[model samples]
Target: MSAALRIGMDIGGSKTAAVALDDAGTVVAATELGTVRGDDGVVDTAESAIVALATQTGVAPSGFASVGIGIPGQVDRGLGVVRNAYNIGVARLPLAQRLSARTGLAVSLDNDVTAAAIGAAHLMRLSGTVAYLNLGTGLSAGFVVDGVPLRGAHGVAGEIGHLAVDPRERPCPCGQRGCLETVASGSALRTYWPAGGDHPGRVLLSAIAAGDAEARAAYDALVAGAASCVRLLVLALDPHTVVIGGGLRLLGAPLVDGIRGELDLAAATSPFLTELELSARVQVLPADSSAAAVGAALAGNL
Candidate 1:
């Protein structure tokens, strides 16, 4: 009989993806599926998604050595439980425990962003300190040193979205006021949008391209959020390179240029700051967001 394969599943606020990586780290098979919507459709959706994946690829659950799920929520890695996942309506759910029960296979769970970071570090072929930044419906950062994740004591170390932006601003879902996500995320862009634009990124970018004054102002705010994270990222981790991914990265060159400008302003303060200016040096590849699933699958296996 052939050796069983390792399965990686990346679950985000929007969708879920799975990849089968063999012993060599090469993806042998992969698939993506939408997240369960509405209040009453989660459990079956989650179960069927995997069952479908198994059917699609002929990867029967019993044939796989184990399954890893990378989730975009607070995870109690210790207990393999998802403390809370508002979008998915999961609370204190024993993801790994339950999956293991359902499939009768070893299951591993990890923060989606953490999995992405590990994938990024590996992609860049970096062996030392590395940081992975994910800009999904939410933003998160995770550190991997010598191939291990620093899953902070509270399991929230990478929760940069909740990082405060302005104490006087709007209340965040996390119950805090003026969270960085409030001023910077795709959601924030939608909220702060000036009245006359189509989709948020296009509206913002069109104005930025036209040098529209209001657009430029809003752009500054958005970039500021990223820069603030960048500075914090540098001061704390000093990673050789910070891999930036997520939906926001789709903006491409314009995004890179804007961020480089902010890093420059942040630099005048310290040369070390300038040294980390990765606008041009950093490997900002088209983010293969599926990597998170791969990392998740391999998390405990490694």
Candidate 2:
């Protein structure tokens, strides 16, 4: 018998990515497309990704046993309604039902981080507890203890991006001041950025390396911002290892060292830091990253 095939769709703020995997977890096909703006855009983009994957792989959408979606913004997976997707103005949209009707496949839906963490864990295929931090356009996290992503009491537990860090900083979409997103995200970098520049970490690190006092100052602030995040990670959610993903990770040592160095300075006695430092367990997001989309695709198996 031909093993069943599962289709996974990962929709983000600006693009849609999809993958088809056989029972063996081999990717049958992969495709990506641009965002379809507005409510109609959601359906258009989803249909496009679905059709592209189906057509390219010679796999009928109906032939798939399961389909999963990892979406930005709020989702009520129990009912398959996207409560409030800020990215594309998709509010209370019945995503699962809509897609299921179109593809004739059982659909699984979840937050992007939840999906990404799931995929990353599966890639590493680790046994113990693992946590994933997505440093995407914004910051978010998901935890998988023994291969299961914890959905929390309300199924919305890991909102690490919303962790408040600064007292005198800007507010967040969550109606709070000093959230981690305010300082550490690509969105935050736009505020103080010089136009036509490289990535924030690259520019900042360059400045520091070149002995630019301004760059040093910027680096100091970034380290402090990241320290605030690491400090909280130590106190609140102590995981075996923190997997850092997103464009910011391209900064490499500046990203890892800055966080660890500041964390050591602020949290002298943290077992979490001790464990990480001792084990060298910190892993950065690779240049060719696919964990998020893959995790979104595997949500049904979870």
Candidate 3:
């Protein structure tokens, strides 16, 4: 008899991706679709994506053992509900239950970043305490302890992006001022850049490379805020590794190098900081991998 297949879907703000994995964890097929707004739309999109993947893999829906989903915003896995996903316009949705009803398979849901952390940990073969810092549309993090992403008491343990890091009191959609995300996220950087630029991050990086003073200052602040986030994670959890991922990670070496420079400067003045070895512990996720979807599939097995 053939091994049962597992389906994993990553419900992102702009796009939804799904992957079908055989029992051994090898991806058999994948599909992508643009996300639709509203609770019913999102659920329909997820169901469609899974059907597409199953078709691509030449397997019937009943061939899958389970379906796992990674969604942005607050999710109650136990209840299979998405409490609030502002980016995707879904609020208090019974995502898993709805998807399960549509696909006739068990469904599991988790925060997208947490699913990425689980995938990153598996990809890197990391054990013990690990941190996954995602600098995507908004900044957030996921903590994994002993190979399981720590969801915390309220399932918000790694929502560090909202922590206030700047004294300037910049407004945040989360109704906070000077949250780390307000200064360091991709969305925040676009707001900081000159209006009408086709690519704000690239523009800022190019100007910084050209030694523009204003661009340098702005970029410096972003790096400083990110380094502070790393410091906070290190101090709080002392994780064995801090893996950086998400949209901003596309900046590649320049982004990692900039963060390292900031931590190095701080370590020079504080022996405790030096002891943490923040620079050495930091790593970036590999390019061209759909980590969240993979992790969601793994979550199903778990």
Candidate 4:
């Protein structure tokens, strides 16, 4: 008999990544494509990913054991619905139902950050509890205990970005002023330095090197806000390890180093913070890690 394989897809604002995992959970096939926007476009993108993976694996779409999607949004996993994912232009989507109907496979949905947390733990071979902070276009977090994800009562356990922390009182989409996201995310970068254009992170470090004062200030805020997030995670969950993931992590070593520096500087002030070893616990998600996609595949098994 053909091995029962699982297919996983991580649908982001700009790209959709998919993978076919063998029974042993190894990714045997993988592909990435530009994500189309809107409700129909989102469904089509996912369907295309599944087809591509099936073709690569020589398995018919319906032959796969299941399909799991990790996407940014307010996800109702039980009903397989997604809402308020503005980046991908999906206001509301019956994602699982539509995809399952089309492919004749059991479909499951997960919050993208949660899926990344699961994938990060498995991929990095970490033990005990783990907290994944996604420094993407927006900030959010995910939690895992041992290998199980904590989705919380309303599935918004890690929406810490919306927490108001800054006295600057910058407006956030969530109708709050001075929210952490307004200070820390990709979107915040645009607001902090409009001259850098829409995708500023691409050129931010270079601009800072060129003595762009605005860029430097913005970068400082991002680093500080992210460090604050790490501190927040420690205070709340005290996870053994905190893995940083998302589009922004692509900034690479500088970003990680800056966050660690911030943590260390704060720890210098208080013995309570020093004993926590916050800097030591922080880790950057590998650039090549297919954590979210792989995590989606694993999530389906649950």
Per-candidate TM equals 0.86, 0.86, 0.93, 0.97
Per-residue C-alpha lDDT of model 4 across residues 1-302, encoded as one tens digit per residue: 25588988899999999988888788899999999999999999999998898889888878999888999989999899999999899999999999999988999999999999988998898889999999888999999998899999998999999999889999998999999999889999998899889888889999999999999999999999999999999999999999999888888899999999999999999999999999999999999998999999999755
Following a full C-alpha superposition, what root-mean-square deviation does model 1 have from the true structure? 2.9
Question: Which 10 residues in a row give candidate 3 its minimum summed lDDT?
Answer: 193-202
Give the better candidate number (2 or 4) by TM-score.
4
* Per-residue alpha-carbon lDDT of candidate 1 for residues 1-302, written as tens digits (9 for 90 to 100): 23467778887666778877777776777777787743334444556656766776686756777788888667877788886777776766777777777777787888888887777666566677777766555667888888887888887877878877665487787898888888667766766765424347656777667777766766677777776776677678777777677777776677767777787876778787666664543445464546687778778754
* Candidate 1 collision pairs: none
**Any runs in candidate 2 off by more than 4 Å, and if so which?**
1-3, 194-220, 267-279
Residue 34 in candidate 2, Cα distance off native in Å: 0.6
Backbone clash count for every predicted candidate, in the order shown: 0, 0, 0, 0
What TM-score, to 2 decimals, does candidate 1 have?
A: 0.86
- In the range 223-254, model 2's lDDT, one tens digit per residue, is 57766655565456666666776667777766
Q: For model 3, how does the per-residue alpha-carbon lDDT over 61-118 read when each residue is reduced to its tens digit?
A: 7667888899987888899999778888987899888888887889999889989998
For each candidate, the alpha-carbon lDDT, in order, equals 0.71, 0.72, 0.84, 0.92
